[model samples]
Target: MKKLFIAAILFVSSSCIKVIDPESNYITGDQLASSADALAGMVRAIPVRLVNYQNDDAGIEQCSYHGMLSMLEMMTTDMVVSGYGGFNTTSAYTYGNLSARGSNRGIYPFYMYYGYIKAVNDVIGLIDSETDDTTLKHYLGIAKAYRALFYMQVGAIYEYKAPTDSRYTEYYVAPEHDLTELTVPIVTETTTGLDVKNNPRATFDTLYEFILSDLKNAETLLADYTPSSKVYPSLAVVYGLYARAYMEMASHKNATENYMQALNYAQLAITTSGCSFLTEDQWLDPKTGFNDMTSQNSWMLACSISEGNTDGQGGGFHHTMLFGTETTYSSYGWRVGRSLNRKTYEAISDNDFRKLSWLGPDFFATETHYDDEAGKWAYTLRSADDTYVGNYRLTSDPQWLRNRITVANGFLAMPWIYPGIKFRCYAGNYTSRYPGCATDLPIMRVEEMHFIKAEAQYHLKQEEEARSTLKEIMNHRITDSSYTCIASGENLLDEIMLQKRVEFWGEGINFFDAKRLGLGVDRGWQGIGYSRYQGTYDIDGIAFFWTIPFPTAEEDGNPALQGYNNPYMYNTAMFTYQSNAALSQYYGIPPSYGN
Candidate 1:
């Protein structure tokens, strides 16, 4: 597979450079359909290129999907940036003073996704003109599916144009403003270079209509195609994408029909894909937890790493977010950016298996057994007969706790008490050379379908049905089956959102969910002291949110888009933080928070 990918890149690079086509030089619409091998390589390169887009000549940071996700996850209230010693981009975004003319937070995704869109359009254009073969349409379908997915992502970040009738205010602009007007351009195979140069943002209704049309075509074309890898978009993936889009659309209306559409498509994805939710044991596996191929069975779509792919060495997701990789990669290491909010951590039920995804407050007594498969030492409490209970325990033995917790190399630092390990590097094996990890990133999972279905049912006012659906997923995840949800009214949605925050913790959908639902987040009283943003903000208000701006560079290049930037405002004072004596005892105060 590595050799094949290298050959594909060689083919793409070695060809004569085309001034007209910037993304690919070797392939034209006419030449693309000539050979099966060439066509396959071209299709294969789409995902390879998508995942490999790390940085550019500008001071842009990691722009890969995983990188973008890590950035977005850190912005949410569920996460706390424990330190600011790493990327300045993380620090800039955490401060939430992003300007339309300057911020890389909004700018990098545009660069990344537009590059991908152009590649997909090249393939789609070839197929549209030359091929009638069902096999060829499979590639076309895959391209369209990917295009829809990218458009959805761009729209979610920049501006989500709601249905014209929506009563929801356009987030962060003004009270009366709504998202009826779109801020993103709708690019397709038919869009020429000239069209791109003169592109104007379309209406929200127009963009979504085109997205749905593309998805509908993709679904029909890929109906008989079985994907070769979990990373590839298959029929099931198309259904899942459709369900996700509809769920976002449902937020615009008070009707049950859109919710029903979301529910139905989610059901199709679950049943057609034949995927199952991860068991508690599977989720807690130290060797291959949420970040590797062991969980691929539940993933409808994922990103696969191969030898030909770039390691994204200094700017990759794991390099910046996971501290355990510090032993291997010193230059790209960070130990404090991925801490969990203490309040959100406490909200989780003790019996829930997801709590194991992060480090707990309790310190263990001693260094214990090394599992051969894990290739890492884990502290475990044992019975009198030396029968092991589990991988974790609470210990008040100060001598033992102090010795183990305060190890050299900054291991288990106080502020990193809830170090998030959900998206860490795989144990025992390195996917690439040192500093470059090969852990696969899942894009969509089977458990998300259940959450979508439950949310849809809740919106439709099917309270009992929604409760049962939520319980179905909860029963599989927790050790105590007797635990029941008592949330009603708005609390029901709160419960659903909490489950999502837990399930997808580091996988990266929390901020987007908060954006779509117009939810406010409090970065906890304890957490406000740790965040560079100072405190939480209403996601739809003027203070802080994950909303991106159309960069000034883009505005300067495109004459049609001048003066089109969104409103910008900042809070006058930092949020007040009431000190907690117990928290102060657990973690000592730093010199300065925003430092």
Candidate 2:
């Protein structure tokens, strides 16, 4: 898909309100609905780009398809797998704090982000300005939900520390007293030549606070609202936002409550509102369902794009992160689309169709499903070798494309040529190369709700309820009556957490989950893989919380931000893994938190 690459995005205007259609010079009930561009530019959309910028969730599925490669950082796959040893990321990796709001090409999008925010504010202001009293209440609620959603994502990925407490001085972004005068922007020598903006990243506390305010107001507007808003935001979508926010806060109880809410809305959207999961056949076949996100199964999608459509591009991230496993490529070599870890691939049962989508050991011709007859299953196979081997696409010639062969046992298996499979659909009309390239980003889903409820019930000691919840979610995948469920104490929580990590494989939730649950990034002996971000440091040894080593301390330099840490940072000497202190309350920077 052709990406929209404009030079400079306008910041939120202080004096003039450039409403979505200040040009139309008129008002109508469909003002918000009429302009999809205006609605899309809201704060809700910025994080989609930001998450692409932040390579937090790489070893997962979504990235393999697209959006995983160079969302934020400029590094290549080799550089990411092996860190460039030094104080800073080795030259192998890309990204040098393009946080500042300006234009220089790769970083220009940052300004465009604020411009979108400005558009959202414009719509919001119009809603407030309208004297007609013909309220676009539902649309307004959706706008608020999206605004908070965008900010939440930016806060998590860009901000160094969580704003557990906005007043904490260590925070990267906070609303501070201008002191002697109106703010003229502050970089404080700490973040010098990088041209990266400081004082902009939102802290967890402030970010969540912003989210809560938006959500509360949204609830008020959404109380009598229906689910017939735009495809991007809805009641279920708002709850999804809440589910994510609470999960980040470590408020399992609240998280559970809201995730269930998300599921209910999802079901409502599916059965009544028109949305549902794609049939197995739609797996890697982008033409049928991958891009048609409004289907009931869609809990959340970045935005749908179809083959050959300009809107279909998976942004440029696919080319940057997902490097394939030493596979032979036509020309550009095998620079993009990496292979999935065998362990992760192996975890799936043969019956689990999704697992089959990725190329497995038994290599054959390049087809996976048979064409002579109809096929049905929950899993659809994604071609690692660009051919519809499973009789997926009815081709004119038999030998031209890989065709599935039926065995005596009556089971049809797609012949596989390569060892690795690429999940991303190639951009059809836009770019002939990556047809599996999908653009919509998933932030939440029903599967996530199931896990959220399970976690909540477990904490409440509602063992039966938790079991039933987990069963409800898992039953769809594994129906064996004897399949055991291991969930109790840490096991139950761990099971819940693991399920989330797996379900959200590429949706970008792992790193933060580890911090909220107090599970350090280090899996120790369990995780033998190396991290590019670790450089030569003891990444494998140290427990990685979201703790950004003090920027002042790091050679890259700390960028200034607005607010303080919601919960203050502690000195290095005072740092402790175990803390009875409420996370929202602690806010002092530890004197020795240097990496």
Taking all chains together, the TM-score of candidate 1 against the true structure is: 0.81
Off by over 4 Å in 1: 1-27, 54-58, 84-89, 160-181, 294-296, 307-314, 317-327, 330-333, 364-416, 430-436, 524-543, 570-595
Poorest 10 consecutive residues by lDDT, candidate 1: 1-10
Q: Tell me which residue pairs clash in candidate 1.
A: none
Count of steric clashes across candidates, in order: 0, 78
Best by TM-score: 1
How many clashing pairs does model 1 include? 0
lDDT of 2: 0.38
Model 1 Cα lDDT, one tens digit per residue, 89-137: 4544555555665544556767777767866776776675346798788
Candidate 2 residue 349 Cα shift, in angstroms, is 3.4
Residues 1-595 of candidate 2: C-alpha lDDT, one tens digit per residue? 1111121122231111223433344444245445556544543433333332222111111122124222332221112221111212112222222222222122332232333343344446535523334245655666677667655544443344332322323423332432111111212112333644444443345556667888877766766655532344655566656666665655433655644554444344333324443344544443432334453364553443334433223333343223222212221212222223333444455654455444443333332332334322112433445433342222122232122211121111112112233233332222243444433444455555556667757766777777777766665555443435766777877666654554444444554454345443321111111222221111221122233222221112334533322212222221222221222121111112231
